[model samples]
Target: MKVVRSDWSRALLVCGKCSKKLDGGFGPKGRESLAKALRRHLGLEKGRRAAMGVIEVKCLGICPKRAVTVIDADDPHAWRLVDEGADLDAVVETLGLIRR
Candidate 1:
C-alpha cells in the first residue's frame, strides 16, 4: 500500500452541502465557504503540510436549518452546527485548533 506523511495535528470535516446552501455565509465579506474561511483565518496552506486540516466533506446526514455541520476528528461523537456568518474565533476555540 502506498503511504504518505502529513503534519496535521488535528482535522475537521465540514459539510459541503450546508456550506453551499448558505451561499457563502462566512469569512470577512461573508462570501466564503467554511473550510476556505477557516483555512484563511488559520493561515493554513493547501494540502497535508498545514498545521491542521479542514476538509469539506459530503452531507453529514444532519441537514440543519441555515447551519453547517462540522465534525472534529478528535471528537467525532459530538458534532458542531455553525450558523451563517458565525464567529470564526469561536469555532476555532470550540475545535481547539492551535495556529502554527
Candidate 2:
C-alpha cells in the first residue's frame, strides 16, 4: 500500500451542498465558500501540506437555513452549523484550529 505523508494535524469537512445552497455567503465580501474562506482565513494552502485540512464534501444532511455544516476531525462529537457571513476567527477558535 502506498502511504502519503502530510503535515495536517486534523481535518475539517465542510458540506458542499450547504455551501452551494447559500451561494457563496462566506468570506470578506461574502462571495466565497466556507472551505475557501476558512482556508484563506487560516492562511492555509490547498491539500495535506497545510497545518489543517479544510475539505469540501457532499451533503451532510443537516441542511440548516442560511448555514453550512462543518465537521472537525479532532472533535467529531459536536458538529458546527456556521451561519452565512459568520466570523472566521470565531469559527477557527471554536474548532481549535489555532496553531500552537
Candidate 3:
C-alpha cells in the first residue's frame, strides 16, 4: 500500500450526510456546504493546503437539526455542530485550526 504523508498539523472531518442535508446552507446567499465554504473561506487547496487538512467523510451518525457535525482530528474528545452561514472565521478560531 502506498503511504501518502503530509505536513498538515490539523485534519478536519466534515460530515457528508449532514452537509448534504443542509444543501449548500453556507457561504454567501447560503449556497455552500460547510466543507466547501470553509475551504473557500480559508483559501485552502484540495489536498495540500498549508498545514491543515479538511476532508469530507461518510455520515458521522450525529445528524443535527439543520446543521453539520464536525470532528476535529486534533481533538476528537469534543465535536462541533456548525450551523449554515455561521461565520467561517469564528469556526476556525473556535476550533483552533487557524488564526485569522
Candidate 4:
C-alpha cells in the first residue's frame, strides 16, 4: 500500500445520499452540498492538502427526516443530524472545526 501525507487535523464525513435527497440544501442560495458549503466556508482546498477534510460519503444508515447525517472522525461515537439550511457556524462548532 502506498502511503501519503495530509495536512488534516481531523476529518468530517457527510452523507452523500442525504445531500442528494436534499438537493444541495445548504449555503446562501441553498444550492450547495454540505461538504461543498463547508469547504467554501472554511476556505479549504480540495483533496489531501487542505487544512481539514470534508468528504461526502455513502449512506450512514441513520437517516433522519429533513436532515443530513454527519460523523466527525475524532468523535465517531456521536452522529449529528443537521437540518437543511442549518447554521453552518453552529455545525462547524459542533464538528470542532476552526474557520480559516
* Each prediction's TM-score versus the true structure: 0.94, 0.92, 0.89, 0.95
Give per-model CA RMSD.
1.0, 1.4, 1.7, 0.9
**Candidate closest to the true structure, highest lDDT:** 4
Task: Give candidate 3's error at residue 27 in angstroms.
Answer: 0.5
lDDT by residue (tens digit), candidate 3, 1-100 = 9977786778899998888888878988887889888888877777864557788999998889988999998789999999867888899889876643
Clashes of each: 0, 0, 0, 0
| Ranking, TM-score, top scorer first | 4, 1, 2, 3
Error of 1 at 3 (Å): 1.5
- Relative to the unseen true structure, what is the C-alpha lDDT of residue 55 in candidate 4, on a scale of 0 to 100? 97
Worst 10 residues of 1 by lDDT: 91-100
Quote the lDDT for 76 in model 1.
83
Model 4 ranges with Cα > 4 A deviation: none
RMSD of 1: 1.0
Residue 46 error for model 2, in Å?
Answer: 0.2
Clashing residue pairs found in predicted model 2:
none
Where does model 1 exceed 4 Å of error? none
Q: Which TM-score value belongs to model 2?
A: 0.92
Tell me how candidate 2 scores on lDDT.
0.89
